[model samples]
Target: MRVSPINAACCVLLVALLGAASGAQATSIYRTTDAQGNVVFTDNPERGGEEVELNPLTVVPSGQRAPAPQSRPEASASPSSPSQAVSSPFMPYSTFRIAAPRNEETLQTGEAGNLQVELGIEPALREDHRVRLLVDGAVSQSAMHSDVFMLGNLERGERVLQAELLDASGEVRHRSAPVTLYVQRASVNLPQNPNNPN
Candidate 1:
């Protein structure tokens, strides 16, 4: 069989594209506890481990789309006073005042991060403050009578962090704007100068 140079070049190009696409898949891990109450997880099939996979979401290819409308089921119920609610009604409060780590978009997964909330009370309302570290809508840390929270071992991915402050009456005093945590995956370390242990 005779093969032309152009045909060989096209074949090479296709193979290269396929290889690149396959390598672009993002890898994720699943965590679970073992029988003895010890954490055990793996990614290799030979070792009886399962691998997790995540796919990237895309809207417009090169342009921004309209913002999605929020469905507020709780906010539309009634107008509750901040001092009367049993506990922050799980609704929106005053504007958030973020002060620490100005750039939340630069956080890397498994890295340390911090957040500071400043109350915007015009007359300095007498309320016992509380703070919580929410990762992806889940409370990872919580504290009362505190204004600053530190986050560590953050996972590699996008997460929404918010702070909810309750008044002395257990009412919603203030809520910080949800900050976006854009965590990047760490690079794989390649062995260098192998067999150098002396």
Candidate 2:
């Protein structure tokens, strides 16, 4: 085929333009803070502008091929095959006890008859573990993350309080030694005599 002079020149010009574009590198960006406390980022620099270096762009040549991605091993489809479980960084606590409000002790009722309960766990409590307070063998409080708990308006009688460590799924992992405490409250009563008024 006989090529025209104009078409050959156009083809050469197109090739040059494409080569220049492919070889071009990114310009440095400048960052500056204006007098009004506004952050400005631009390619141009003035008095207070500082040149910022950016990560280089990765370029893959068209002539060279990329490596194939590696495939992961397939898991077993059998129901009897045990799957690998995710391991936690923290281990279970060995000793869990109630630090405050000793067993068989009497506590003076506060203004609203509230009692504070504090727990002590060995190796500290894990992030996924929670504390639950048991009153008379029943769950009185659930999902307490802190070691301190407050019970409001307890009756003036002997009560049993127990602390339990539960996992994220609400499963009991550890139980503290049961603590028996007596709540004391003052009573207001009138004189038995008819004319007892002073």
Candidate 3:
């Protein structure tokens, strides 16, 4: 059988194209339409061909697994204040004492036996501490955050007043110097007793 020249030329062209593709890297690709309006892609730039832009390629190894997700550290659960800690290295307040109702002060209010006691603390009181009032070595009022204490119905005689500073855990941290208070209540049987309807 005689070899056709057209077929031989086609085969040679195909081999040449394959050789060019393998020998050089395809850095850019150009797209254009042929005479028959068919789309054609080639590495050679044509007169009216459009250059296609390519993004970076991502590669994954065959048998290698992705890095495990890192774990986030948990936030601290304890409080940030230093005063609340029982093992604080130093005291927060330098001056803690009772400011009002001076020692040996005589109180004669018409309200029978009511007195307002004030506390003096250097700087300021922290949220983790509390104050308690003591009368005659006994707790007259429970612990609270206020700096004032109202004593009601105090016995008509000499009374001892003291203020105690408590920590967050209800532990005594400091105590003011005891104060002596003298109460003068009018006797009911006396002529000046207002409650008597004479």
Candidate 4:
């Protein structure tokens, strides 16, 4: 079938207008409670229940008038902290504890050092156990025997390491608190005389 040029032009124009209208309607809606305790919304809110506005439109061909990205709410920063995360119901079955290279009262780190972790079961050992170390949700290392897991080449930054202890039944018997290891280059204590032996 032979199509006329005028017909094609009209179809193109129709599509463009529809796209623009849809884009304008696709916006985030914000809600807030009104002074009378009723939920209210407005493109412009003169009073305080909540003021909602579409993120201002911008044209950024040269990246000059780009829109600012939304910032996350302060409460959403970390949902896994001990204070934030809900306590596990299984915690009552087993007691959880973690031993580090340094004392539990304080934590320290070495540049190319190791965090010797020993996970234990309360009331002494009755069954075989496995300990797994997870770094940011990924399994770093798993040990059948309670031994020191080397933490070498730790960068100088705040590192969050998680350790879980599992019993023979493959159930999480215990889990360490998300230990935040503030790693720093270990200060070396060198002997005064390298050549002389006492």
Instruction: Please rank every candidate by TM-score, starting with the best.
Output: 3, 2, 1, 4
lDDT of 2 by residue, 1-198 (tens): 344577557545544444445444565566566665545555555555777565454567889877878899899685421122111112466567888889998867343358888887778888888888887788887677888898877777888998877778876666677899887755545344232344
Q: What is the TM-score of each candidate against the true structure?
A: 0.39, 0.48, 0.52, 0.38
What's the number of clashes in each of the models?
Answer: 0, 0, 0, 0
Which digits, one per residue and each the tens of the lDDT, describe model 4 over residues 90-154? 33335555556333222344224345556444645444766678765667865455544665555
Model 2 clashing residue pairs (backbone): none
Best by lDDT: 3
Which ranking of candidates, highest lDDT first? 3, 2, 4, 1
lDDT of residue 51 for candidate 1: 53
TM-score, predicted candidate 2 vs. hidden true structure: 0.48
Better of 1 and 4 by lDDT: 4
Candidate 1: clashing pairs of residues = none
Error of 4 at 106 (Å): 8.3
Candidate 3, residue 156: the lDDT equals: 89
Q: What are the candidates' C-alpha RMSDs?
A: 36.3, 22.3, 17.0, 22.3
lDDT of 1 by residue, 1-198 (tens): 344577557545544444344444533433334455434333334545345343453434448776788976675667677544433433343334445545366664234333343433323333455555566778776556555556666665676776666655655455556677676545445234232232
Per-residue lDDT of model 3, residues 130-197, tens digit only: 98999998998789998888888898899999888888999877777789999977675686676335
